[model samples]
Target: MKAPEGADLCFPLLLNNSCRKPVPPQSDGMLVLLSFISLLTAALNLLVIISISHFRQLHSPTNLLILSLALSDLLVGLLLMPVEILSTETCWFLGDLMCALYYVVDFIITSSSVGNMVLISIDRYLAICDPLRYNTTVTLDKTKICVCLCWMYSVLYNSLILMDFLRHPDSHNSCYGECVVVLNHITGSVDFVFTFISPITVIIVLYLRIFMVAVSQAQIMRSHIAAVTQQSSVRVTAKKSEMKAARTLGVVVVVFLICFCPYYSPSLMGEVIEDSSSSSTFVVWLLYFNSCLNPVIYAFFYPWFRKSIKLIVTLKILQPGSCDAKIL
Candidate 1:
């Protein structure tokens, strides 16, 4: 997906331009590989979410937030990825109405994924920073309200993109039946601010506060443990739990930054410079890479997630009186 000449942005292609054209028929192999990976990762995450949800023991606030994020990614895998694949093969072919619908769905799901991240970060912040107040602050009612607001915010943010598309006249295409929007710079700038910049800013600030709280709590816990003789083991266990939470949160924040920075950078550039470049294509693919990275992150960086997967896959470990069996 080289930059369409004169367009503000371009879709990311998996392979470099040198490999894009070849005497052999393997030109599109990289795109297919990426699509396959994205689809598989999305499916696995959905399955994990469903398995956890089906079991009553897994019905905690943290798990609920994970479920919400998985659902958002699942929507992207199902609705957006196929269109992206089609667009890679040929110019969009579903005509004006479907194209508009595609754009809306993409924006909504992508925005929702970011929104879920923000909410999850806040949840973790409260849980770690003020453990006593965590339960009261993140009650079922509050969680539901937060989730609803995330969806509502996504809808409102994407509505502008939809409006921009609708306002522009449809293109009488040369090959594909899809209608492409003449990217309006003003609306594009607004989209960048609302969809990318604001949400990212909020996430960074919340995480910073959460980190400070975690550090303070750890210091207090250490002091209490040093003063106690009998409760040392209990304090040690609590400390370990806190460490795990910190590690998981750290991974989430780092991955979010690395995956999203490239995708959003082009949008920022698009606002200032209307010229389309190959960098835009690169950013699009980088964003697509994000959809698949979460499952790997969970399975590798988070011990609890890895244990849950083990329980699901290996029934041999699920003994008659085991905690694993009880979780199932």
Candidate 2:
């Protein structure tokens, strides 16, 4: 039997006020593809979280920052990505209040993700350029504090942004099925400053300094390799490992910038951007897709992540001594 048109109504009891179900992904396979991406993102970031949390050897300060980044990306996958993938959600049935709350959470996660990147850049800068003080300055306890503060500030900042929306959820909704909050030029540009400009400035500056110091160290290493003694060779090897990590994280920062730029471009153009527009929607998902790529980058660059994945899939992490297995 063919279903009646009324059956698609979100609130059948209030047909006049209710929204019909939105169109699904353009192709039948598109939903499958997006759902798979969401699942993969969640699973990969979960592996990163579990790997660092469970392994004794992997509990370094840098890994702690990576763990923080993974947690934020995991939330993006689990909480945000599915929502974005659902037919662009033009016919939002979740109601006005939910829509307001959803964007608040979205902004918080995004802000924290940017904060994590800045923290990672700082960690790498210290590791590469000032190895002697890195350990004392970037302690695990201090990193934990910084991560906590990052999330707390994100919550506070975004909550303020959505304050009016929370109070009057439907104030900006244009139709029965619609759910969106538009930011004016002033708010949008200010948000761009806090969310993009400041953090990106810090990341770029620190990474540039790191790159300079790395090149200088490389030249000196090449010139003095023949004269270096055994004790100094051990130091050189350690520095090389840190430099490699810096380079890998540099890739992550570059990818972050690429994915993030398009999403914030409209604000740069001094125009108000709706969250519901086709172009904005595409860029939103593009950044969401970056969460899925983070762990893939880790798997490619980090041997421990690969080994940990093997152990996790092979069920070895469940064994009694797995925490001390020294995969690194």
Candidate 3:
């Protein structure tokens, strides 16, 4: 049954000016599911954070990028997910300034997460396709700098993209208790190119090349292993390691695209999208759900993550020399 006539107004006192609460067609089960996902997203990414941060062996260039990505995902669960859940059935009582700030935070974290994924693809590409220079070229210090630059670029780029909204916060709002942001044709196109097209292009191309190289390496390793030569064995072992890393990271990239592509489908159609629309809401939550899935993927694929989680859960990580424990 529909809610009673005036029951949906966010501000019953100013019924005419207030936007009605958005009661999405959500079942109680779905609401509970979303809540569980938000909590699980936070918990899973938090484990990744603690696993990578506290473990000395995980302090590598690639893990640093993963850490950066996890941090952004954690923000999604902690900050964005709850807001999204509340938004589904309620009107935005937080003023325009807060709305603008929320978008700013959302854009920065989301963009930075995308940037980090690109960096990870590049890292895997080098490890597989150019193993000779991968170590020197993609060092811990360099990865740290790149991670910093990615976040900085996200902040600056999104701020510029939303400059008008920041200046005139409620320029698009038709009533109180509604949070919505719409990008114009020009700004939307520009954002699509930078945040979606270019990064996706780079990731796809690099992964394709990495896939070919990994396949070739795998075939060579299998064909030559019977020789049992020391040099050949060493080469095979290295290639095998590289291929394994590529496969694991490939799963991550594929999942990222699956979760994110739907969210950007409107922009792909060259349309101005409203964030508050039902389709947009569903896809946005799908995007947030990716954050929860990442650590689960890691647990299934990475032995280190599984071990770390066990130690963390069993309180073994609290030991004085826990950081020195061999995890890999």
Clashes of 3: 0
What digit string (tens of lDDT, one per residue) describes model 1 on residues 1-328? Answer: 3434444322234222211211222567877776796688678677657555655666677767777887887776776666555555544434567666666777788888888877777787788678898887788767877888889888886776567465543542222333444345676677677767887788778877776676677777777777677477857776786786567667777788787776556566674422111124445556655666765664334466666666667763445544434542
Cα error of candidate 1 at position 35, Å: 2.8
Superior candidate under TM-score, 2 versus 3: 3
Q: What do the candidate models score in CA lDDT, each in turn?
A: 0.63, 0.79, 0.82
**Top of the candidates by TM-score:** 3
Q: Rank the candidates by lDDT, best first.
A: 3, 2, 1
1 versus 2: better lDDT goes to: 2
Per-candidate TM-scores read: 0.75, 0.86, 0.88
Model 2 global lDDT (CA atoms, 0 to 1)? 0.79
Model 2 misplaced regions, further than 4 Å: 1-21, 87-90, 225-250, 277-279, 298-300
lDDT, residue 307, candidate 2: 92
Residue-level lDDT for 78 in candidate 2: 97
Question: Model 3 residue 44 lDDT?
Answer: 86
Q: lDDT score, residue 41, model 1?
A: 61
Ranking of all candidate structures by their TM-score, best first = 3, 2, 1
